[model samples]
Structure formats: C-alpha cells, structure tokens
Target: MTEYSEISARLAALSDDQLTVVLQAATAGRPAFWAVRAALDEMAGVGNVTPGTDVSPATAAPGVHDQVTGGGVSGQVGAASTVPAVPVHPAGIPDAPAPGGYSSGGVPTFESVRDKVEQRFGTAQGMGELDRQTPAGRSADEQWEAREKAARERLDRIRKSMHDNDTP
Candidate 1:
C-alpha cells in the first residue's frame, strides 16, 4: 500500500468530517498518519478554520513531516499492536477460553480461581437448625438399640414356637 504522504493529494476528495475520522484513527499509527495529518493541516489553512478545532495533530509537528507511519505515532497504539499479526487459524475457531488466562503482558492466565470449598457444620442437607427440618433417619446409636430390642423379641417368640426335639 502507498504511504499516506503518497496519497495526500487524493485525500482532498474527502470532506472535512471524513478527513477528521481518518485523522483520529490514523493517530493510532495507522499507515500514513502523517499524510492524513498533512491533509488536515492543508484544509485548515485553505478553509480559514477556527482554532477551536482540535486539529493539532500532536503526532505531527507543523512543518515537521515524519512520513514514516510508526515514527510520530510512537506509543499511539501502545500494547494493542503487540497482538499477533497473523490471520486467524483457518482450520477452526479457537476454544472459548483459548487455554490460558487473558493476560496480555506475555503471561498466560487461568480462569478465575473459584474453589468450591464447602463446609458443613451439623448436617449434609442444610444449616445447623435447618437440618432438623429434614428427616435424615435415626441416629446410629438409636437405630442400634431399636434393632437389638427387636432381635431379642423375635428370639423369644421363636423359642416359644420351637418344639422340644430333645424330649422327642
């Protein structure tokens, strides 16, 4: 692509508003920011534009034409330009998380740590007092006592029902 400087003459076709949009985006170090800037400066001069306009292409000093795109817009795009310039993989879309955490400063990040550390004080169903509402069956000691009593009663009934085989 031709540098903005090479295309400065062509920019005259764009209206004042259009020129402003290009200038705003180009300040982020888009290729040919200097050329867009030069066009704006020329418009300001020819149209008797008021100083109220923020056309102060701070990246490009008056008469200091650094035609290189990345020069004057140093730090304009900042860390964003650090993203990989390669096209997205054509094979398939990446997973939602893309593996590591979203740290961009060379460090891979993991998902937010949300350990499901649960603590139960009294019962499994609910909080201490609330557990009483749920019928969780008899306690171990109570169940054992009830079971033993039933067994003894059953044995007595069986003894009464048994025939005296020794006597026979």
Candidate 2:
C-alpha cells in the first residue's frame, strides 16, 4: 500500500480518544501546528494574503487553496472541491467569562481602603509609635555613624566569606 493509504488506514483504525491523544501529540510544541492553523485560517477566509506578482494560483501546490478567494486552485487540474469548513470547539471547553466584573466575592473599594489607611496613619498625632526608642545618650550624627560602622563591619564579613575558601 502507498504511504498515504497506510496513514489513512491507521487514522481510520484509531478510536475517538486515541485520535484526540494523537492530535494532541501532533500539535504539542510543534512549529507545523501554527503553519497548519494559518493555512486553515486562510482557507476559512479569516486572514487576507497579498497576492504576489511572482506566483499565481496555477503555480501553487496541489491541495493548497488560493488565499485571495478562499477557494481551491481555480480550474487547476487535480484540485479537490472546497470542503465545508466547520468551526471546531474542543469538548469540555468552558465559555470565557465576560469582562469588567470580578468572578469571585466582592472586592473592597479603593475609597474604603484609603479611608481606613487615612484613619490609621494620616495624622502627626501617631508619630511617636516605634516599639524601641532611639538611644538617648547619642546624637543623630553619632547614631548614624554607629549604623554606618555596623553596616561596614557586616559588609567586610560578607566580602571575607566570599573571598576566603576557609574561614579562620
């Protein structure tokens, strides 16, 4: 038997589930999947293709439909009749939810959230709210210098750890 006939026989022998699995495997991560889809889309008259002056419909490969008219090679020898295109909706597919509204429970309004935040921290009255106060003995400059020294020490330890293969 010819390769085409063999393929047709194998396809005909596959069960519905087996055919779906085969189709999924064929399309998964394959570049040809998009090409076939584009060809189908062109055949279904979904996209327009600019006609090149170089190649005409007569020169196109057999079974390839003309992009301009969404028809098979017009009057070309060995061209098959145009097959009726059916819109394919895969089984178990859920209809997409309409836009502009939350699907789940109600969300808090931005105004309400802003009002709560303003009520909590929008005044200078709540300024001294820290758990630990700054050192009373040290001035601001001295405290900043101490922080800088601590940061430098920590950075030096990290640099030493990165450079040294074995720590002393």
Candidate 3:
C-alpha cells in the first residue's frame, strides 16, 4: 500500500492518549505534520490551501506580520516596556514569629528556656528529692542518677552567675 495509507492506518490504530500526543506535536512546530499534509496534497495535485477568505494584499499571514519596517497586520512594534518599581522601606517591620513561638494571640516571645525546662522536668530541687533513696521517692536508680546530673548542672550555672556578679 502507499505511505499515506500506511500512515493513516497507524494513526487509526493509535490509542486515545497516543492520538492526543500526536495532535499536540502537530499543534507545536516541532514535528511539522502540516508539511507532511502539504506533501500529500501536492501528490494529489492540490496546491497550497489557505484557510478562510483572503484579506488585504498588504497583510501577511494570519498571526505573522512584516517585521521589516516594524509594522505588521497586527500593529507597530516598539521597545519593550517594564513594570514600575515598588517603593522600599528602610526599617522593615518585623513579622510575627511562627506558631511555636507564641500563643494564639499572635505575639512572638517565648517563655525563658530555664522556665520551659523546669516545666518539663519539675524544679531542679524537686528532681534532686526524687533522685533520693527515700521510700516515697518514685524514680529508678538510673533515672535518679540522670536527674542528679541535671540538678548539679543547674547548680553549677547558679554558682557561676553568683561568681560573675561578685567579680564586678
């Protein structure tokens, strides 16, 4: 059979998705299926066919225009214009910190780190009492050891603060 018939048969056999891809490729200038269509028309002795009625002789193709004198069927072309610049502020307003930093009211400050730590693990003195081997104490030996280590660290920080103040 002829190449046209073979191509037509292949197109007929294409799946819907394949047909869509073919149509998109044809619409874009890449594969140029219109060139093949033109060739087929020439083989059938039909000259170039222009869609719809012709316009003024001075006009170029449908969307295309004569760029020589910067004037076309559309309009005259000029230098590309740019968008206006936005005003700048020197002292930028600070944005509210993220949700984790504030309560629902949109304020940004957080509780002191020591306050947060104490909230999570009671007071350092309370933790030291829990670490004691009293009958009422609830923590395991390892847990008590860990809590004692934390309490000692907190005490060291307090002592360092006292020493630094005395130096002045």
Candidate 4:
C-alpha cells in the first residue's frame, strides 16, 4: 500500500544470489544507506550507530565497537589508548630519487627537482629543458631565441590552417 511496502516487495522478489550481489555492492559504495550500515554492524556483532549520530571516541566503547577485519586493531581504535607518537622532520620524508644525487646521509633531497622545475618555468630566458628542443650545451639567450622561433612557427602553421579551412 505504502511506498516503503512497495519497495520492500520489489526487494523481496529478488533471488538469493541477486540479493547477495546487490547487498555487496550497496555495502561498498553506498554507505549512505542506514540499512546497509545496520546490516554490517549486525554481522560484525557490533551495535549500530545511526547515520548522522555523532558518537565520539570517548563514548563509542560501551555501545559500539569499530568492527575491523584483517588481523586486529591494536591501539589505533580507541581514545585514551596508550600509543606513543613519533615526530618526523621534513628531512626524514623521502624525496624524489635522483640516480647520483642523494644528499643528507643518503636521504634523497628535493633540490634536484626544485632546480629542474625552476629552470623549466621560473627563469625569464632559460630553455630549462624543452624550449625549442635546443641541443645540449646551449646558452640561455640561444635557448630563448629558439623558443621564440618555435612559437612563431607554430603560430604561422595555425594561421595557415585557419585560412585554408574547407568549412567556410
């Protein structure tokens, strides 16, 4: 009679295999559905926290437990848990690797990449690498001249193509 019952009838009509497929997909990409979350909690022996309910870490232990699979949760689960925090410096973060250019005690640095990017974009007259495809060992002035020539050539080609268009 009602919309809920009509939708229920449609779902009830699906075979077991079809229902399983649908439920699996719904559980994965469609967690907005409260029913799917409830079903997940039920299967995991955990209580269902309603959608939009703010269950902070402090209060979640009594009513609900995060059902984590694949091994088990050690200390990453709950608040007030004893887990030491490790400080990491910027130098500790691994940078883009260069074949012969690792600095700071073999911890790769970003200086090489920074230099390349700056050469390519930051400089006024440096070909940096790609401007006009200049051969190796070209001066910055030569590279800029080649880049300017390439731009003019490309512009001429584009203009020629536009004038020779068959459409109009």
CA-RMSD of model 1:
16.5
Q: Model 4 residue 94 lDDT?
A: 60
Go through the candidates in order and give the clash count of each: 1, 0, 0, 0
How does each model score on lDDT? 0.49, 0.53, 0.54, 0.56
User: Of the candidates numbered 3 and 4, which has the greater lDDT value?
Assistant: 4
Models 1 onward score TM values of: 0.18, 0.20, 0.19, 0.18
Best by lDDT: 4
Clashing pairs in 3: none
Over 96-165, each residue of candidate 4 has an lDDT whose tens digit, in order, gives 4547657646854577767777776767455444553565545666877899999999999999998899
Clashing pairs in 2: none
34-120 per-residue lDDT for model 2 (tens digits): 776565544444456654434465664544232233343344688653332223436576433224332223555455667778877
lDDT of 1 by residue, 1-168 (tens): 234444565456654445554555445455657666656656535345665578655744444342222323233546343111222224464434433444444444344222122333224445544644446633644677899999999998788768544355
Top candidate by TM-score: 2
Model 3 whole-model lDDT (C-alpha atoms): 0.54
What's model 4's TM-score?
0.18
List the candidate 3 regions with Cα displacement exceeding 4 Å.
1-93, 102-114, 120-123, 133-168
TM-score-wise, the better of 3 and 4 is: 3
Top-down TM-score ranking? 2, 3, 4, 1
**Sorted by lDDT, highest first, which candidate order results?**
4, 3, 2, 1
